[model samples]
Target: MKNLKMKAARAGKDLSQQQLADLCGVSRQTISAIEKGDYNPTVSLCIRICKVLGKSLDELFWPEE
Candidate 1:
């Protein structure tokens, strides 16, 4: 899995992990795990993230092809 470009993009928007986590209804650790490629989030989680980031799921997560 790719390390999260999501975090980078969020940072570009000046959003902190805690802020993003709150917006996404998840923990900071969950955001950290996602950023580190340490967790494969559920589809629902992915959708939440994408929605929060104003991105589509495909823009955030690509399969390991």
Candidate 2:
């Protein structure tokens, strides 16, 4: 499924995909793929994104009911 939560958090921080990617030490394509649900990020990558966005794993990666 698409990661709307991550996208929202990124937008809330006023960051572009490239900006978030740089902060997370990943490529912009990786960030884009995650947001688009075309990629499943590793646990470590998820944590980096969470830290950069000031969000918890659940807030971003958990599947909502």
Candidate 3:
């Protein structure tokens, strides 16, 4: 359940975890936890992250087939 997609997308946007977290009103550790697959974000947080990264939920957070 490692969230490589989220990590890659964040890198593609040239954003640090702290920057994304700031944008989404979350803490850096929260972003780190998500990227590390140690935490599951709420839907609202997912949408905020997607918006900042210009990604859809499917692109950033959905499980791959």
Candidate 4:
């Protein structure tokens, strides 16, 4: 599934995909792919993204049931 929560959080923080990717040391396309559900990030990358977004892993990556 697409990671809309992460996208929303990024928007909430007024960050573009490029900005977030820079903060997380990744490419904009990588960030886009993650949001599009075409990429599954590594645990360390997930933590980095969560930290930059001021969110927890569960909040950003966990599926809602």
Candidate 5:
């Protein structure tokens, strides 16, 4: 499923995909893939993304029931 929560949090922080990717030490395509559900990121990558967006892993990556 798409990680819309992460995308929203990134937008809320006023960051573009490239900015978020730089903060997380990944490429813009990686971030885009994550958002679009075309990729499943590693746990460490998820943590890095959550930290950059000021969100918890549960908040950004958990599957909603």
Candidate 6:
């Protein structure tokens, strides 16, 4: 699966991993893992990220094909 691209958006918004994690109710490590493609976030986490980034879930998380 293609990994989701989140770090750019976070950086564009000037949000640190900890800040994003706090907003999403997840740990900093979770944010790191997701950004690094070491972990795949659950649907709930994806929803929260999309909300925070002001993007649709389809824009943020989707299979390559």
Instruction: Estimate the TM-score of every prediction.
Output: 0.87, 0.98, 0.97, 0.99, 0.97, 0.85
Clashing pairs in 2: none
Top model by lDDT, which number?
Answer: 4
Between the candidate structures 1 and 5, which one is better when assessed by TM-score?
5
RMSD each, Å:
1.5, 0.4, 0.5, 0.3, 0.5, 1.8
Q: Which stretches of candidate 4 lie over 4 Å from their true place?
A: none
The better-scoring model by TM-score among 1 and 3 is 3
TM-score of 5: 0.97
Q: Point out where model 2 deviates above 4 Å.
A: none
Q: List the residue pairs that clash in candidate 4.
A: none
What overall lDDT, based on C-alpha atoms, would model 3 receive against the true structure? 0.95
**lDDT of candidate 1 vs native?**
0.86
Candidates' C-alpha lDDT: 0.86, 0.98, 0.95, 0.99, 0.93, 0.83
**Model 5: per-residue lDDT, tens digit, 1-65?**
88899889989999999999999999999999999999999999999998888889999998998
Order by lDDT, highest first: 4, 2, 3, 5, 1, 6
The digit string of per-residue lDDT tens for model 2 on 1-62 reads 89999999999999999999999999999999999999999999999999999999999999
Model 3 / residue 37 / CA error / Å: 0.6
Q: If both were scored by lDDT, which would come out higher, candidate 2 or candidate 6?
A: 2
- How many pairs of residues collide in model 1? 0
Q: After superposition, how far is residue 58 of candidate 5 from its true place, in Å?
A: 0.4
lDDT of 1 by residue, 1-65 (tens): 54557877788778999999999999999998999889999999999988888888877887545
The residue pairs that clash in candidate 1, if any, are: none
- Between candidates 2 and 5, the one scoring higher on lDDT is 2
Q: What is the lDDT of candidate 5?
A: 0.93
Q: Output the number of the TM-score-best candidate.
A: 4
Worst 10 residues of 2 by lDDT: 21-30
**Candidates arranged by TM-score, highest first:** 4, 2, 5, 3, 1, 6
Task: Estimate, for each residue in 1-65, the C-alpha lDDT of model 4 and write its tens digit.
Answer: 89999999999999999999999999999999999999999999999999999999999999999
- Please provide, for model 6 over 1-64, each residue's C-alpha lDDT reduced to its tens digit, 9 standing for 90 to 100: 3344687678878899999999999999999889888898889889999899787777677655
